[model samples]
Target: MKLFNRFPAIIHHDDSTTAPSLDASLPARKWETILFSTVLIWTFLGLCFPMYDTDFWWHLKTGQSILAGNGIPGLDLYTFTDADKPWIDLHWGFQVLVAILYAIGGVPLVTLVKAGVVTAAVAIGWRACGNELPAWKKSLVWIFPIICIAGRGNERPEMLSQLFLAMWLWIAWRSEKQPDWMWWLPVLQIIWVNCHALFVLGLIVGFSYAVDAVIRTRWGGRFGLEPRTDGPPLGAVFVVAVLVALACLINPYFEEGALFPLTLYRKFSVEKEFYRQNIGEFRPPIDFVMQFGLSNLFVISELIVWLVTAASFVWLLVKKGRWSPYRLILFAGYSHLAWQASRNTNIFALVSAVIACQNFAAAEVIRSVSVAGSTAGDRPHQTGKRVKLAQGMTGLFVILTGLVVSGVWNQIGEKNKPFGLGEAPNWFIHDAAKFAGRDGFPMRAFVAHIGQAEVYVYHNGPLRKVFMDARLEVCTQQTFELYNGILAAMAAGDPIWQNLFREGEPPVVILDSRSSRPAINGMLQNPTWRLVFADKTGAVFLHIDTATRLSLPPVDPSPLMYPDGEPKEKSRGK
Candidate 1:
C-alpha cells in the first residue's frame, strides 16, 4: 500500500521530465508545417503572374544570343555607330540560363521556370525564419513573404540572392552549435558570390556571425544560460571568409565581373534619367501603399514588427534580466535596412516575423503550463475539447483553400491573356533580317522584308547576328540617345528629320503605317531618302541619293523662290 501511494508521485515526476522534450519537438514540427505552407503559397502566386518588366526583353535577347554560336558579345553589336565599343554582360549567366530554357520549351515554359525558382527562394527564406524562431513565431514570417510577392511580383536576380541570404543566415546560426559545419559557409558564399553581386551581403552576414560568436564567448558563455558551443577550431571563420572572398573571382569576366556592381552604382548615381525617373525598385516604400492602394497594410505590418520587438526587449529585461548581444545586433541591422528604403520592407518584415514568432512560442508554452495546472481537475474533458477544436480548424482551412484556389484561377486567366500585356516591336530582329539577306532592297521591299524577317527571326533568326533587339540595356548610350531623339523630334514635329538620312543610317527603318506617321511624313519630304517599298503593316525608306535627286525638282537661283513650290491662293469655301 505504501509503494502504490509513492508510485503516483514517481509517475508525476517522470511526466514532468518528458514534458520539455515533447515541447522541444513541437516547435520543430510547427516550423516544418509553416515552411511547407509558405512554399505552396509563393509557388501559386508566382504561377499566376507573367513576366511584366521592361528588363525581360533584354533578358530574352541576351539569352537568345547566348544560345547561338556568338557566345557572350564583348562589343556592342546592336547599332551601326557603337559596334566596336567594349561591352560587359553583368547578367550573362542569368541570360544564358533563360535562353536555354526558351530554346527547349518556349516563352511560357520560361515563365513557369522563373516562377518555380522564386517559389523555391521563398521556401528557403521561410525555412530560415522558422529555424531561427520559436514555433509560434514562425507563422509571423509568412506575412512578409506575402507582402513582398504582392509588391515586387516578378522573377528577378534579387529574388535569387534573397534565397542565398536566407541560407547563409541559417547556416551561420546553426554554426553556433556545430562549428564543423563552418566549411559549408565558404561553399555557399562561393556560389552566391558568383551568382549575383548581392553575394557581398553574405560576407557582411558572416562577419556579423563572427562578431556574435566573439561576444557570446566572452559574455554569453559566462552567463550560464547561453547555448553550449561545439564551434569549429581556431581561425576557422577567418579562413572561410578569405576563401569566400576569393571565390567571387571565378566568374566570366573574373575581377571585372566581381567589381562590376561598383561601376553600376556610380552610373546609377550620376545618370539623370535613372535617378530622376520613377523606377519601381528605387521608389520609397510608403509609395507602394499608395501605388497598390493597400489600406495601411504596410504600416500595420511594420508596426507589428516594431511592437513585437519592443515587447521582446521588455520580456528579456523582466525574465532573463539582460539582452542577448547577438539578437540586439540582428534587430538593429534589420531596423537600419528597413528604414533605408521602402523596398526593404520585405527584409524588415521577415526579421520582425521571426522575432514575433519566437516570443509567441515562448508565451504559448507558459500558457500551456499555466492552463495545465489550473485544469488539472478537468484534464480528461479539456483534452477532448482540444481535439474537437483541432478538427474544426482543419475543416476551416480546407474551405479557405477552396476559395483561394477559385480566386487564383480567375486572376491567372485575366492576367495571362494574349496582348493583354503590351508588346514593344523588336527593332533589332527586324533590322538584322533586312541587312543580312541581300545587298539592299527598295524602300517597299525593305519594309516587307523586315516585317517578314521579324517572323523568320521569331522562328529561325537565332543563328544570325542582330543589329538591335529588344534588349534595351545592351544598347549603347549613343544608340539610345539617337533613338530617343528621333522619337522626340518626330513627336515635336521638328524639321531636323534629315539627320536620319545622313551617311550611315540603319539600312532600313521599319515604319508601322499607324505608329510611324511622323517617320512616314519625314521620309516623303527628305530629298536624299526615298520610299522604295510599302505594305499594310509599314513602309520602308531607302537612301537612294541619285533616284531621290531625279524625283526632286530643280533648285532655282531666284531668292525668295521655294524650290518645287507653286503658290496657291487662299480660297473661301462654304
Candidate 2:
C-alpha cells in the first residue's frame, strides 16, 4: 500500500480523482439528488417558456406520420398542393422520438423530454471533464448551460445536433489519453448521421483528429513522448467518417436527404428576405448595447459568456504552453460562429464554459491553494473566511431562486409568448376540423392556418412546391424580388399586384400577420381576393373563384382600417 501511494505517478488516474472528498463525490443517492435538483431548476427556468420560431409542431407532425407506419416520406406530405414535391427527412430519427413523446403525452411532455435530454448532455460533458474542477467552478457549469438554454430552447433538429456535439467533444478528449478508446467514434457517428444533418460537423472533427494523430506520431518519437498508436486510432476515425457519410443515405430520400442542407446553403446565399429577416439566433447583439434594463438579462449573460471565453483563450496561451493546433482551430471556428448571430453565441458559451472549468481546475494557483489546506477538500481545510464566503453565495442563490418562484421572474413572461403575433388569433385553426368546411379551397394548412396560397413568378407556391416555410430564406431570389416588388407596388397600385392575385390563383392563402405584411397588403388591394376572416393577430385570404364565390361574403374593409381614415399599418419601420 505504501509503494502504491508513493508510485501514484506510475498509473495515470482519471481527472475526477483529484477531488476525492468533495460533496459531488458523495454516495449515489446524494449525487442523484444534486443532479436532479440542478436539472429541475434549469428546466423550469430555461425550457418551460417556448420561444417563437420553434418549428416543433412540424417536427411533431413528422414524428406522428412516421409512427403511423408511413415511415419517412420521400416528399412533402403535410400540404395538399405540394404533397408530391420532393422532400428529404433529414432529421427522421429525431422526428420519430419527438413523435413518440407527442403521441404518449402531448406538447407539454415535449418540454420535459427536451429538458431531460439537454440536462443529460450537459451533465455528461461535465463528467467527461473529470473531477479536476473545484466545487465552485463545477457549479458554474450548470449556470453556463442555463445561459445557453434561453437562446437554444427552440425545438428544431439542431437540438439533437447540439447533444451530438457535446458527445463528440467528450469522446475526443477521452481518446487523447486513451488511444484504444477511439473505436467508439464510428458508433457515435452512425447514430448522429441518422439524427440530424449537422453530422457533417462530426465528420470534420474526425478528420481533424486523424490529422492530429499523424502529426503526433511523426513528432512524438523525436521528443521521447511517443504515445501508443497500435490501437485503432487512425483506422477507427477513418472508418467512422466513411460510415457516417454513408449512413446519411439511410433516409427515405437517400442521397437527396444528405445533400439537401448543402443545396439550401447555396440557395440561401442569394435570398434577400432570408438575409433581412432577423431570426432570434441570427440577430446581432449590437441591438442590445443600449438596453440597460432587466430586459437585457439574456443579452448580458450572452456577452459574459463571450468575454470570459476570449479571456480564457488568452489565459490558456499565457499560463499554459500554446494550446494544441486543433484546439486553436476549434476555438477560432467558435469565435467566427459567435459573430455570425446572437444564437450562435450559445455554442461559444458552451465551448468557453468547458475550457474555463478545465483551465481553472488545472491551474497551479488552485493546486497551491489545495496544498495550503484552503477551501473544500478531503484534508483538514480552512473554514474561517473562504467557507463563509461560499455559504453566503449559496444563500444569495437561494434568495434568487425564491424570487424566481414568487412571480418576479414572470416579469419575463411577456417576452415568453412563443407564437409570433403574441397569441393565436381567433381566425387561427388549432385543429384540422376547422378546415374541413373549407375543403373546396385548394390551399393546404400548416399548423394554425399558415401556409402558401398563391403562385407568383419568383414565388412558386401557387404552382410548384415551396422550398420551405414562408420565411424569406426558403424562397428563390426571384421570389424575394417578387415579394419586395409586390410590397412596393401595394402603395403605388403597381400592375404587378394584378398578376399576384389573378382570378385563377390558388384557392386560399394563409398569411402570418407577424411576418407577411406585403403579401397581405397586395391581396387586400385586389378586389378579387377577399378576407374571409380577419383578426388582430392574423387573417385568411380566399380567392373569389367560380366554385366558391357564393359561399363567401364580401369582407368588411372597416374591420381592417383604423378608427381614423388610414389603413391599419402592420409593418414596424425597417
Candidate 3:
C-alpha cells in the first residue's frame, strides 16, 4: 500500500487511485481539431522540399561506413588533411538512422523521415504549452515559430536533438499528472548522447526543473511567486536529473562524447572568429542586420519574436507576480545561443513560443475563446455574429494555409529549389563527383567549398579522400587557414599558392562555379591549370601536365564565360 501510494502508476490497479489525464482539462473537441489541422499544415510545408543541406551527404556517408564494419570511427577517414585526427562521432546514431532510411527508399524517404522528426518536435512543443490557451491564438503564435524554425530546418541531426528536448520539456511540465514519464528521459538521453552533441541540453533542462522543484518545495511563495501544489516531489525530480546526467556517459566515447558539446560551445566565442565569419550559419544575426540593414525579413522576424518573448517574460513576472525558474533559465541560455549564432534561432523560436504561451496562461490574461461557446448571459444575436466571424476567419486561415503548404506562397522569392524529392541542384556537384570517381582521375583533390566536399566524399569516399570536409571538430585551425590561404592566393594568380599545398596534395581541383567564380576565372587564365570538366553544377580543373598524361581534353572557356565576355584582366598579378 505504501509503495502503491507513493507511485500509484507503477503498481496501482484501482481506478480510484488514477489521476486525471492532462487532456481531461482541455476546453473543447473543436479546438483540438483546429490545433491538429494547423500542425498538419505546418508539417506538410516541411515535407514538400528537396534535400538542401550541404552537410547531410557526409553524415549519410559516415552512417554507411559504420554499417559497413567501421563501427564508430575513432579517427577521421574522409579527409586527407585530418585523416589521423581524433573524431568523437556523436552523430553516429543519427547517421545510421538516415543511412537505413536511405537504403530503404533513397533520398525521398530520408526527406520524409527528417520532416517527421521536425514535426514531432514542433508538435510536442505545442503540447507543452498546455490546452488552456485558445487554439486559434496558439495557431497564430505557432506561425512565428514555424517561420523561425524553417530557416534552420534542414536535414540534420540537430532535428533529433530538438525532438529530445521537446520530450524532456513535455515530461517536466506534465510530471504532476504523469510522474512515471520522468523516467523515460534518462533512456532518451542515452540515445541522444549517441546521436548528437546537443544531448547536453537534456541534462541542463532536467537539472533546471529539478532545482526549480527543490526551491519551490519550501519557498514557493517567496519572491512574490504563487505557491504550487501540483508539481512532482523534489526528491523524485532531483533523482531523475542525476540519472539523466549519468545517461550521457553511455555513448561509445563515454565522458568524451558527453563533453563534446562544450567543445562546440567554445567555437561560438570570439577566439573562433574565423569559423564564425567564414561559416554562414555560425555568423550572428547582428552581422546580418549590419550587412543588409533591416532589409532581411528573416532576421527582422526573428528579432520581433525575440522581443515578444522577452516581453512575455516580463509580463509573467510583473503582472502575474510569479516566475518559473526553469523558464527564466531557458530564456537566458537560449537567448545567448541565438544571439551568438544564427543556426540556433530554431531552438530559440521553439522555446520562446512555448514560454510565451505558458506565461500568458499563468498570468490568466488569455481566456479560451472556443468557437463553439459563449457566456450564458450573452445575447443570442451577438453570440451568433461572434461565432460566425470566428468561423469565417478560421476558414479563411485554413484556405491560406493550404495555399502556402501547396508551395504556392513558397514560389514567391524562394531561394531553394521548387518543391520535390531528391537533392537540390545547388546542393551538390553530382556530375563532377561522379566524374572524379572514374579510373583516370586523381584519388585526392582540393575541394574548395565545404558543402561540395560533403558531396565528393559521399560519391567516392574510402577509395578517394578530400582535402577537407565539414567535420570542423576533427579538422584543425591550421588546415582551415591553409585552405583559405590557397584559395586567396589562387584568386590573386600568385605562384606562392603552389607552395601552400600539402606535399601529397592532388594536381586536381574541384570548385562550385557559383561560389568559387573568382578562383575559376583565375585558374582559367593560369597556363598551369586546365579546366578538364565544366558544367552548371561545378567545374573540375587539373594540372596542365596531369591533363596531358591522362589524355583528357580541356573544356572550352567560351561557353562558361559571362554574357559581357571574359574579364580583360583575368590574371590579377601574373
Candidate 4:
C-alpha cells in the first residue's frame, strides 16, 4: 500500500516539472519578434529622464541672449559673483542652434532635436562597431552598449561629443581605404571648437589614427600585423596633424577655447585627487560598488564590459589576429576612464563596442558557417530552418528600423508633456512675473532656493542671475561649497542667513517648506521679509527693504500650517 502511494506521488511530481519545460523551443520567427520588441521598448525607455540638468537652463538662456544680443555675451550675464568675468562661450554655436530651435517650436522641438541627435549618434556608433559582421549581430551587439549609455543622453552639449566621437571613428575606419577624406578631419575641429568643451577628444581620435598608421607600417611583423596598403600614406599625416592643432584655434575664443580642455582638467584635478570627486559621475568605481552593492546595474554593466574586453584579447591571441593599435588604445583609454569615474562609462561603451563587436564577429561568422553546413541527422529540415531563420532576422531588421524612427518621435512627445512626477513644475515661474512686474526681481539678491532650473525657464529670464543653477562647472569651484554652507547655516537656525542676504541679497526667495522648515522658520521671525506667494510646489518670500520690493500688500507672518506647525503646500510632490 505504501509503495503504491509513493509511486503515484512520484509520477505526479515528475509530470509537474517536465510538462512546462517540454514547450521550451520557441519558433525562430516568434523569438526574433520578441527580441526586436524588447530592445526597441528599452531604447525608447532610455529617453525618459526629466530635464533636471540645470546646465540646460543656462545653456538655453545663453542661447536666447546670443539671439537677442546679436552676438555671444562676452561676459557672464547670469551670475552676480562672476558677472562680466570675461566669459569664453566656447559653446556659442550650440547656444545659437538651441535658440533657433526653441524659437521654431518651443520645448517640443528642442526635445525632438535632443532625441534625434542621440539617435543619429547611436546609428553612427552602431555602424562603427566594424564591418565583416552580419547586420543582425551588429545591431544586437550595439543595443546593449546603447542601454549602458542611455542614462547620459540627456539634452546637453555632451551629446554633441558622442556624435562627433562616432563620426571620428567612422572616418578613422574609412580613412584606411580612402585616406583623402582624412584631410576633412581638421575642418571638423572648426565646428567642434564652437560646440562643446570636450572637442579635445576629437583631436585624440585623429592622433590615434595617425599613430596607428605609423605603427603598422613600422611594426607589421611584431604584432602579426601587415601594413594596410589601402590606408593613406603615412608621410602626409604629420602635416595634417599640425593643421588639426591649428584648426582648433579658429574659434572666437581663439587660444582660450583651444586650451579650455587643459585648463578645465587642471581646475578639476588637485594633485592626484580630482575635485570632480564631489560629483557622483566622477567618483571612483569602488565607491559605487560599496554603496550600491554588486547588484548595481552600473557595476554589473562594467563587469560585463571587462569580460567582453578580456574575451576580445583571448580571441585575438587564439586567432593570431592583427589588433589595430588605434582600437586597442581606444579600449584601454576608455576603460581607464570608466574605472576613474562612473560617468565616463558611456565613453567606454562607445569605444569598447568596437573592440567587442569585432571579436564577436569571428564567433558569429563561425556559427553562420556551421548553420549553412550542418550535418544531416541532427536537423532533418536544415534547409527549411535556415530559410526561416533568415526570413526572421530580415523581418526583425525592418521592424526595428521602423520602431526606432517611431520610438524617437514618441520620446519627443513624452519629453514635451508639462512637468509631472519627477519634474519641476512651472507654478512659481508663472506667478513670479505677475508679482515682480515687468522689470523682474533683483538679481542674486535673494535665493530662489528651489527647482533652480525651472525658475529660469518659467520666468523667460534674464530676470536675475541665480547663486546656484545646474551650470556648476561654469561657476567657480568654491561656489557649491559656499552655497551649501549658507544653506546649512539657515537650516540650522543660525543668524548667518541675515548676513548673507545683506551682502548678496536677492530680492525674492523661493523656499521648499517641507525640506527647508528651519530656514523658513528663521525667515518667519524676520519682520522685513514677507511671504507674498505660497503653493504646494514652493513658497516665495519678498524682502521688503523699500517700495521697490514690489507693490503687493504686506504679507502675514503666519502661513497655512500643517499639524507640525510648519507650512505645507496644498499641492503635493516637489
Q: Which scores greater on lDDT, model 1 or model 3? A: 3
Model 3, 1-574: lDDT tens digits are: 1111233354344331222222222233444455556665655565557787888989999999989987888988888778888899999999999999999999888887777788888888887877665555566667667767766767899889888888878777777566766877778899899999988877767767776777777688998655668766666676777788899899999898888998888877754588877888889999989888876646876897788778777888888788888787888888888999998888888878888777776775543554346454443554344344445546755775675656674564245634567877444788888887788788887887878888888899967998877787888778888888888877888868776454653547888876788888888878888898877667888887778888988887553454233466764532
Question: Could you tell me every candidate's TM-score relative to the true structure?
Answer: 0.64, 0.74, 0.89, 0.76
Clashing pairs in 2: 16-131, 454-462, 455-462
> How does candidate 1 fare on TM-score?
0.64
Stretch of 10 with least lDDT, candidate 3: 16-25
Write model 1 residue lDDT over 1-574, tens digit each, in one string.
1111111121122232123322233434444454446445544443444454445545556567777766876766443344575666656667777677777876666666665665565555554443333323344345444444434534445555666777776566545554545667666766665556556666667676667667666666465325436564336766777777777777767787667666544333445254223334444545555566544444555655666776776675566554555556666776765554554565555555444444433333333454436554454464444444434444443443454455643343222312211233332233323433333332221222222333323433334333344333344445445555664464454748445645543444445554456666665666555555444444555556533533533222221122123345422332
Residue 167 C-alpha lDDT in model 4: 78
lDDT of 3: 0.75
Q: Model 3 off-target regions past 4 Å? A: 1-28, 365-375, 378-393, 405-408, 411-414, 501-505, 558-574
lDDT of each: 0.50, 0.52, 0.75, 0.60
Shift of residue 274 alpha carbon in model 1, Å: 4.0
Tens-digit per-residue lDDT, 51-141, candidate 4: 5454565677778777777587666665665665777778878878877887897655666677567666666665565435444455556
**The CA-based lDDT of model 1 is what?**
0.50
Off by over 4 Å in 4: 1-45, 48-50, 271-278, 294-299, 362-440, 446-454, 457-463, 501-506, 512-528, 544-574
